[model samples]
Target: MENKTTILSLFLIFLFTLPFSAQESYFPPEGEWETKEATAYQLDFAEAIEFAQDNEYSESRDLRQAILKGFQSEPYHKILGPTKKRGGPAGIIIKNGYIVAEWGDTERVDMTFSVTKSFLSTTALLALQQNLITDVNDKAGNYLWDDTFEGPHNSKITWKHLLEQNSDWSGELWGSYDWADRPPSDKNIDEWRERELHEPGTYFKYNDVRVNVLAYSLLNVFRKPLPKVLKEEIMDPIGASTKWRWYGYKDSWTTIDGLKMQSVSGGGHSGGGMFINTRDMARFGLLFMNNGKWEGNQLISEELIKEAVQPSKANTNYGYMWWLNADGPRQWENIDENIFYAAGFGGNFIIVDQKNNLVIVTRWLQPSKIEEFMQILYKNI
Candidate 1:
């Protein structure tokens, strides 16, 4: 009996000393990253591939030609710069920091449209973190003394309001009017243009002109081109590729503090936003999923992230520039509420699901089918 008891104790020690079956973290180093089978993460490989193939966009119209036609007819289309030829359906599913599944030309750099807003938002957050300006609620007029932040209606706007897209900032930015963007189809042009301006923070309107104004203000605050700020601070640290580019219109350049600076756009409404590949997008999503940390370095504060994803009172579905899956009419179905994404026009999305340690980047997918695709993706996990 004594011998048996000693043997059992030795067996338990050995078992406990062995490594557990844990998911491997394969954060790509510089330019090299490895792919793993989906089954390694307990995902059904066949189902994932099937889901990807079945959910492909099946539009009757040629997508790029249609997009070009639509954008060319916009009121301020000329100011939007040129629309780039977009790539076909492409995406990468990253699980536990490894590429578990990918399809299409994942390396092809393509226009990311409005997803640039999230990066713009991050730049603003970086400003806050660096104490360039104190408090997000502080009035914008304090830092930006130009007419852009002037007047009765615009004077009341705050950094927080701009971040949330509820500033109701009444002005012309980069030759684009605030009311001209996605004007209410139900109302006459005059009625929509002459409508009373809602007080900042009390109403939400997704106007690219206003978003451009935010980008312009950030350019002033940073005292440098927005892209340089993004690259030196966020992108470089996260090991993002150099392929991504942010663009502003030809007229958007201006003299600031004795230096010529180009104010970038917050989205691709007129044209030119982030043109990045799926891998770069995945790196960005992974950075957010790790709570703004990468490779044991805290890139952006967790506090900023908390505020970035917090639901706006005006639009519960939006926070800062990141879309929140809040309890609202536009909420996604059957997914973790904590999952947030940077969505762009033309079905470009960088979805961050921290709950499941997943980052999904899909480009040129059917926008309406996104929720269903996610539902299917999660089911495999």
Candidate 2:
């Protein structure tokens, strides 16, 4: 009787001491996700949900109008790809890969804008892992001898520079000139056109044309459509649905290996990026939250993910396409500095909090209110 009691006590202790993730970690299967009550985790996130609902993004649901209005200051800014009428405020909060809370139409597919950059950056990481390209620090021109990376300044650009958006790459891509994108308000068209170029890796500039150049460069490296590369390598293995689509400009086509393929965009700023649903976005967040592992498969190297989140010298709050919550203008006060997220136009965000084992996907929440909303959610967590 004493021996039985001793064994039972040891078993109880072992069960209690197990790490939360080891005991509760889950990976949602295709077309199905499980949910658990927030109360089970001793969390009350109703206030956060209410805040998100109340602070829906004020932009027009007709994203076409919003896109044009938002970039009216830029010369020759035009939509070149597809745009969807965005849905109302939608979000999902996942703890240990199980949905604890959700609101609005989480299934509705919508434009994700620059969040696509996170995915684009992933492709480059994969290329590195597969030894397709030797090193990110290598001159990008070496991979493809085409004129895209020909000039003195352009040739100096490296994959790492482009990943961090500090390339300052010059010239035109798919009819969009690098200088024309996000030009300064104080400068006229010619002045912006003739502006002095910053050395690659010295300055950080958020330009879609430059981003497209990265996409185009990746296309030449992969010798296939990026969508295919993403689907086969990352998405399908993670059990993502078939609904999501990556888009490029209508004329962003190029021949590779004797087959014509579109070089996708890194964002939807000019109307070409990723269109995906909130649930799938959560799956992606979960994958990252798990450090790029999906069910024991290391889809991407853990070292690469760690490298991806490290803040770049040019932007303390920016990593390889991922936004960090470091000490910068974008930092959220009182929040974990390690927190990183994928943000896009129209208030789309996929926030990954590794310390808390939390993945939050919120769409169409007021951009300005995200910090407060995060605070509220963290308060509950």
Candidate 3:
């Protein structure tokens, strides 16, 4: 009787401790994550689904128009690359490492646009951890002595500056003129071209030309392709799908040490960046929400992520290629301030709410409706 009672007590204790222990150690396996209904989280998400459906972009709206407009602007040429048939109203929401909700063709790989910048920034962080380039604030000229970093203005650029999109690098790269990229609608071509250069770290501009310049500099720093670096360090460990592809323009190819290398773009702005499905993006976001740790392994240093999300002095809402929402004048209202996101063109977003242990990947959503979408998701939490 005593032995039986002891066994029963031990079993009860094990049952009591299971949830806590499991919660701390659980991680979805590669390509084999589990899913749960809204009820699993003890929340009604029916209204949330409706809210997401209602906020989706119109199918009839031409997404390529703005891209074409930018392409037809001054000093433009045919952008060389690939663009998949962009699907409509697709998203996936992961709660506590499980798929709580998914909509549209979640498996269809599509262009991720500037969301690639966050990935680009990750490579830089990894390089920092590996001590490849040492300090981010060190002048880019230290590693790159070519024309891209030799000019007085370009020489002042740093890895941090490039990551934050304030490098203001002045030059053409792979046929795209720096001044001609996404020029202000109000400014004439001459005004935009001759605009005074801002000191590297003092100004913020979301220019893809400069972003590509950063990619190029990173290529020189890594002494290899960025995708290979990401694959070995990030994607492979995260168990991301093999279908995703990073692309660069045809002319962007160059030879390095007798090896043919193509430096990928930081966006799909001129067509070519990360083409990944929602599931892989969810894994990437989950990695970040867990503070750069994965499956008990510190994939990226916590200190780097903290600094990565730190609002830049030049732009309060911008970090090291990550968009922040906490304490700025233009903060995302009605949502947790701790949330940060990787935003891209065509309304692709990876909203990371670490506070809730949630990662939401939305593609082709209406940009203006993102705040409301997040708010609705918050209510479900």
Clashing pairs for predicted structure model 2, backbone only:
none
The order of the candidates by TM-score, greatest first, is: 2, 3, 1
Per-residue CA lDDT of model 3 for 230-334, tens digit only, reads 999999998899988999888898777788999999998888889899899999999998888889889999999999999887898999999999688758787
Candidate 2 structure, TM-score to reference = 0.96
lDDT tens string, model 1, 123-168?
9999999999799999988997677878889899999999999999
lDDT of each: 0.82, 0.93, 0.84
Q: Candidate 2: how many backbone clashes?
A: 0
Stretches of candidate 3 off by over 4 Å are 1-22, 59-66, 69-77
Distance (Å) between predicted and true CA of 265, model 3?
0.3
- For each candidate, give its TM-score against the true structure: 0.90, 0.96, 0.91
Per-residue C-alpha lDDT of model 2 across residues 209-327, encoded as one tens digit per residue? 98889999999999999999999999999899999999999999999889999999999888979999999999999999999999989999999999999989999999999999999
User: How many clashing residue pairs appear in each of the predictions shown?
Assistant: 1, 0, 0
Worst 10 residues of 1 by lDDT: 18-27
- Per-prediction RMSD in angstroms? 4.0, 2.1, 3.7
> RMSD of model 3, in Å?
3.7
